[model samples]
Target: MIDYQLDADGLATLTWNVADRPMNVLNQASIAAFTKAVERAISDPSVKGVIVTSSRPEFVAGGDLDLIRNIRDVAQSMDCSGPVSRILRRLETSKKPFVAAVNGSALGGGLEICLACHYRIVADDPNIQLGLPEVTIGLLPAAGGTQRLPRMIGIKKALPYLLEGRKADPAKAFEAGIVDAVVPSSELLSRARAWLLSAPAEAAIKPWDRKDFRFPGGSPQSPGPIQIFFGASGALLAKTQGNYPAQEAILACVYDGCQVDIDSGLKIEQRQFARLAISQSTKNMIRVLFYDMNDANRLAGRPKDVPKRSFKKVAILGAGMMGAGLAHVASTAGLEVVLLDVSGDAAEKGKAYGAAILEGQVARGRIDESVRDATLGRVIPTTNYSDLADCDLVIEAVFEDRAIKAEVTRKAEAAMRVDAIFASNTSTLPIGGLATVSKRPARFVGMHFFSPAEKMPLVEIIRGAGTSEETIAEALDFARRIRKTPIVVNDCPSFYANRAFAMYPYEAMTMLAEGVNPNLIENAGRKAGMPMPPLALIDEVSVELLYKAMKQARADQGSSYCAQPQDAVLIAMVEQFGRLGRKAGRGFYDYPSDGERKLWTGLTEHFPRAEKQPSVEEVHERLMYSQSLEAARCVGEGIVSVRDADIGSLLGWGFPSFLGGVLGQIDTVGLPQMITVCDRLAQHMPERYAVPQILRDMAASGRTFH
Candidate 1:
């Protein structure tokens, strides 16, 4: 709802207050009324100046992300674009000065409306973040944002923000020449009024008004833009491996739009918008990854009546890679982390790791020197459990062995408040076993942080058989506190990402067993544009650790983790010869501590008969398929919510981002086609190649992923 009031001074204030939402959303009804209001504001001569402000707690949030996301038809896309363009064009062509008073966030279409105004005045507060981040929803800014933004702000300046989709603060937006000025929240409306009344009432300059205004130095034809575009395109391709269609369309939109007239550019953007709208990845992404993840996180796996717990201090046990990285993230994100180890030196070493990362941030000017120091200071290093006596949560990262983990749990719980949650950072082991050692097992839950915790976004919050609902909520909260997305998975070995991901490298090696060369699988991973080749990843993760996991698997899964028949190269290196892994300086590839590690020539000594040759596609499929099929099984068995699992893969493992995520990859792979391919491989390797029922049915029904 809106109220238009005209004062005797000839200034009109149009206040927005949506019926009940905390923030305003541009829905069909709102857009329709908004367009009418725009027409009226432009027509009335009594209205000498106009200021758009919100009566709600915050300003307009954006177009409802779900609305445009669900409109799968071309005509619907056109219909949606019409009202947006109409309101913006009316504001642009208005005779009187038009201004926006942004009291809070002005995002997506909300920011677009501000851009359309002759003047935009934002409140100078940490809360006011403005940006045109339409790319997140698999769509570009269709309401003349592509045309007007480059003209309002120089193309070079606008391109970075638009192309990468970043949010800018009010001061930065002012410097970039996007917003007209910034003011305090108390005076935002008053400031907007003064600007509208006295500021150069020069009718808003539209991009279409000028011709020959060359785009910021990087015109597609110019060396600057050409190099940037092509270079960026190549990088995008490498990062996505041609898996995501959205980036391709986004690139095309910016390239074609900037080169042509404003009208032509809009058409290009609109066409791309429609095409992307109907895509399976787009819909699935909007539903599962974006919408679903957001909703689930807000729900936080707790009863609506439960009072939320906020833990400001967390004590993490052990100072290994996971423990150190966890301390870094926890400290940096405004939490006090008590890092404990067996000795003071071990605790300091973990603290040093956090210090190094902070130093890097300082070097990049990402944080001030003092802030970096203060962040490091927040991480208190100690060798005693008593240091965590008052801490709100204590997470153990000591060992995977039941006895060691149970001992750590008892010690951690002793240091906690009566209700302080205790969590274990175990990857494959069951949480129920770990919970048994806790004085209050209901307060103990599994908080499985992926390796290199600072870099990975996923933290599987496992709810064990005896874990309380409150414990699940607390772990989820703890994961968020450390800036990781938490997926509340029911306790199981390997949880989600690793459990589904373990077979990929093994299958790639299996392809090598069938006479495929080790180098062939490695090159296929590279040529396919994977972030890391299978062998290289294995080495970096330390082949020795994988060998340990395999030994553990032998006991749990009933047999040793074996490679494919032709995988004699690794089979001999890890199995027959007992050379162990990276720790042993042996394995499929040899690693010498003093210098760079290289592929061992000893590989030939292991596989005597198999030839070293295979196509790139074959090698890529072996690794990608195994992962994809298992991801499908996880979906079929409902181990994780479909959207959360896909997001987990994209955020957890380096599942080629261009595919959007794993489920997205399945759609792109064409379920039926992939199933047929799997069938062929199944004949030779049944255990590794069998297609999951989801994929088979998707293919059989001619259904696409959405």
Candidate 2:
């Protein structure tokens, strides 16, 4: 809600506070109310100046995304966007000075509102961030942000914030010409009023309003503008691989807007925002990045019947890299951690790993030595099983063998309390198979943390057949406590992430054997927006482990298993060439101690490159589509929800966020079109590329997975 109050000094303050909402967002109702408030202050002869501030902690977060997503067409988008721009224009042209009192973060349209004011004075809070970050969620700043930001800061300086949607601290905001001054939080309102009254009437006018105004970075015809616009095309392609329409739209908006006047520039921005709004890419991004991500982090499917459980102490078995990282995260969250290993020395070494991490933080000034010591002190390292007696939960981070996991399951359960839950940090093994060895199968679950657990954000919570809702709720709670995003999944070998992720390297190997150039394969992977090239990723995950996982999967599933044609490639590399992986300093790519690694030239001897090589587009589809189709199968099998599928793909294995995860890719390409592509791919590799029945059904019904 917007409230207007006039001070005795002829200064009016408009306060923002949305009812029943923690943050103020510019929705239709709010925008209408805001326009009315702005009109009141501007029209009143008694009110000489206006100071805009928030009653809440933050000034305004941004436009309500629900409203943005509701935009069905250009008409609807313009209907939503037009009034705000008109109101801001009226405010700036009223000849009544306006000062923005940014008490906290002013992001997206929030900052755009500030840009319409005569001056912006931010509270010197360390937590405040100011920027136009709409591009992050597949939209540009439609409320004159694209036009105003570039005009204020110049195109070259503003491109990073607009293109990448980077947030800036209060100090950086002042430096970036986003704010005129940064004052203490207590003085924010007072300073705003003072500036509003003292600032010259001519200064209140926007740069575009002045007859002498010139484009800060020159028009599109200027050399700098020419180079920036043309140069940005190749740079953005290299970064995004042309997978995201939003990035290209951003560049287009900035370039096109800069060529015209302020009114025309605002029109260009609004038109571009409309185009991006209706884009399938934008819809997919909003679905996964905003809605699905929020649901996963909030534990949407958490059983309402089960009461929340707070984990006070946790025991970790096998104090290796995974276990050590677990100890660090747990202790960092102020939970008591018992790190156990086969020997006291090994456990101590794990504790030492935590100490080292804490020391690094202290050295970096992230924490003091006292806090480091306190966090390190929380981790109790010992070989004795009795040390885990008081622990509320236990996580087994041992080897990925079923026998070894079962052995630790028995030992950990013997020491754990009867009601305490048990979890495995296995990347590939099925939770149901491991739960069979547990005394309390109902409390057994899988908390699959990726490698370097302290860093990776996702934790795939696998539910066994007998695992209770209480166990899932408790696991999710614990994951949230450690600041990790948890995605609940059904019991399946490799579960969600690894199951789909394996397709990348598999396709790369298949291509290699088919005489595609190794360089081309890796280049396509990078161009397709994977975090690392397929060959490099294989090296990091290790080829020997891949082979072992394949063998285990084949043996366990028997006739139901899908045998990949590229299995022989992995076998030959690990067994015949004696190249285990990065660990062995050799694999698909040779890893040397001195410099950057390159594709093994010897690959040509084993599988010679074809004279007629596949194009990057063909290779990119093979690698990405293989994973996406497998993800569709996972959804069909009910191993994961559509939301979880998207979240897991992005956070779990570094799927391109711009593509909005795997399901997003399907939506972007269209369900029927994706099916057609999969059908074509199946012609080449039926075992890997076969379309799931669910996808076929959806295509027939004209329905999307999301």
TM-scores vs. true structure, each candidate: 0.87, 0.94
Question: Which 10 residues in a row give candidate 2 its minimum summed lDDT?
Answer: 213-222
Off by over 4 Å in 1: 20-22, 199-201, 211-223, 303-307, 362-378, 413-418, 435-440, 517-531, 555-620, 635-638, 656-660, 667-674, 692-706
Q: Please state every model's RMSD to the true fold in angstroms.
A: 3.9, 2.5
Best by lDDT: 2
Cα-lDDT of candidate 2: 0.89
Runs of candidate 2 with Cα error greater than 4 angstroms are 20-22, 211-232, 359-365, 368-370, 554-562, 592-595, 610-612
Clashes of each: 7, 0
Question: What is the C-alpha lDDT profile of model 2 across 550-657, one tens digit per residue?
Answer: 888888889998767888898889779988889889888887799989888889998888889988888999999989998989999999988898999998898887
Deviation (Å) of 528 in candidate 1: 6.3
